[model samples]
Target: MKATVYVTIKQNVLDPQGSAVQGALHSMGFDEVGKVRIGKYLELELNTTDRAEAESRLKAMCEKLLANTVVEDYRFELEG
Candidate 1:
């Protein structure tokens, strides 16, 4: 199985890098884009068939170490 996790800052959070990227894009003539935010994407491979258990473990993994829940939100997709 494979899991792809995305972790990003909640709205109202500061994202300097994203802002920089947006500025660069504007300078490069991509003016339609605004309020860009950055995030982390993690891909994991697991050897398991139990979907529920794997999701539980994956949630725990995010809560414990993969993300900082205090200011970040995360979502994951799993596929076999």
Candidate 2:
């Protein structure tokens, strides 16, 4: 199975990196941007025939390492 995880800061968290990128983009002539957020993506491939087990394990992984539940949000999808 293949899993894709996306980790992003929550709406209430301050994202200085994203702000910097937006500023640079504006300086480069893209002035329509208002807000931006930086995130991390993780892709994993595993040998698992049981989807339920995979999902549970994936969630645990995200909770442990893939995302910081205190200030970030994360979601993942699994595929073959």
Candidate 3:
């Protein structure tokens, strides 16, 4: 099985890197882009075949290390 995790800054938090990228885009004439947000994508290969167990473990991984629950939010997908 495989699991993918997406970790991103919370909506209410300020993202300096995202802001910088947005500013650069605007300067480069990509004015249509707005509210840029930066995030992390992680793919993990698991030995387990149980979808429920994989989801539970993935949630723990995100909560404990993959994401900072205070300022970041996370979502994951499982595949075999």
Candidate 4:
């Protein structure tokens, strides 16, 4: 199975890197761009075929290492 994860900053947190990118875009004539946020994407392969087990393990992984629970939120999709 393959797991695709997206990790993003929580709405209440500040994102300096995202702000910098937005500023650069505006400077380059993309003035319509508004509030930007940065995030992480991850792909993992697991040996199990059970969807329930995969979801459980993925959630654990995100809580433990893939995402900082204090400031970031994560979601994932599974594929075979």
Q: Provide the global lDDT of candidate 3 against the true structure.
A: 0.95
Backbone clashes for every candidate come to: 0, 0, 0, 0
Clashing pairs in 3: none
Clashes of 2: 0
User: Considering TM-score, where higher is better, how would the candidates rank from best to worst?
Assistant: 4, 2, 3, 1
lDDT of every predicted structure (CA atoms): 0.95, 0.95, 0.95, 0.97
Instruction: For candidate 4, list the clashing residue pairs, or say none.
Output: none
lDDT of 3 at 4: 88
- List ranges where model 4 is wrong by over 4 Å: none
What are the models' TM-scores? 0.93, 0.96, 0.94, 0.96
Q: Cα RMSD to native, each candidate?
A: 0.9, 0.7, 0.8, 0.7
Superior by lDDT: candidate 3 or candidate 4? 4
Top candidate, metric lDDT: 4
